[model samples]
Target: RAAATSRRLSHSQYASTTSGGPLQEAFAKGALKPGLNVVLEGRPKQPNDVEGLKQCLAEFRQQLAWVERLDVTLGQLTNVVESVSQNTTDKDAVDPENDFQREMSFYRQAQAAVLEALPRLRKLKVPTRRPDDYFAEMAKSDQQMQKIRQKLKSKQEAMEKSEKAKQLRAMRKYGKKVRRSYKRDISMTRMWSLSEELRN
Candidate 1:
């Protein structure tokens, strides 16, 4: 029950508080440590999985504009979660596949906000050393990202098509109304001209 409530509050905070500037700045400045945290390491691997830790070194380079990359990373994280949901077999799963899904989602959202705050962290000149197992860790993250993306492809494309169809329908409806109004105006103008000629 508490977890569910926490999840709800996280959702509220995510859509509002952490979506803006100061919290992001704190992350960039590496100042707020007692607040929100999103730790994904040490998660139990799936039976078929071979990788060990997820997400490696987001090296905050001093001169680099890390914000854009961070934004992309967040988007990618969202895609990962979506792909997992689309591909999972929830019915036959061990505690049900949807179990922990909410928590994982909250994690990614929080991580995204924290990452957006990376600029201030960079500004603070936080010295972060690359992990000894950096390459392996990165390979794991890459593999997961790719796996999710591949799984996501078909569903994502279908969703895009649906969205496009809706947009097209709306546009066509608006266009039809505009065309009717335009035709009426043109006819009115012609009738006015004819009346003036008749009067002359």
Candidate 2:
């Protein structure tokens, strides 16, 4: 559950300005400088350090490459899950052993990818205030989740109401049939005419 929560946070937090605050601060404070699109550390008033920048860029580039690869891996896993869902819908379908093995392999790869990327990201020496920033992000996420839950609850209620109406109609139809089977008070022709009139 914690792993799932972290993955959700990683994805959700990616688009926010706060996502790279620590990294951004390193650059802003002259602890890390951008040298031709690469990152390097230097004295506050010093010129660009090309070699240090290249090394930092190499590490950052590798991390981004890993992230991209992980995304592709995730997409493949999603496809496999979608296929599994489709097969499960067929009453007679059975899951093969190899499919499960492949799914496990995909999950392991994704987990490994995330673990590898995290270390490289951390190596930037970026400092961040924990608990405070984290708590604020959690509050925002919770609010969004609450709104989603409310929408889902209302939709479920509507569906339940619709299903109840269908069941009531079925029960009424069955009741009429049962009564007709026991005794015939209205003639069939007149009953058909009455039903037509009611429908109109």
The C-alpha TM-scores of every prediction are: 0.29, 0.30
- Candidate 2 local lDDT, 1-200, one digit each (tens): 99999998887687455546766666566666445232544645867899999998888874455434534323234444554556465433334565774565567667766666566557754343367536344545777999999999999999999999999999999998989975665577678889999999
The CA lDDT at 167 in model 2 is: 100
In the order shown, what is each candidate's alpha-carbon RMSD? 27.6, 23.2
lDDT of 1 by residue, 1-200 (tens): 99999999998888676556656666776766675543334876768433322222334334556544444344446454664476665522223345576666667678777767766667767645578867644546777998888889978999999999999999999999999999999999999999999999
**TM-score between candidate 1 and the true structure:** 0.29
State model 1's lDDT: 0.68
Which parts of model 2 have CA positions greater than 4 angstroms off? 1-105, 108-136, 139-143, 184-200
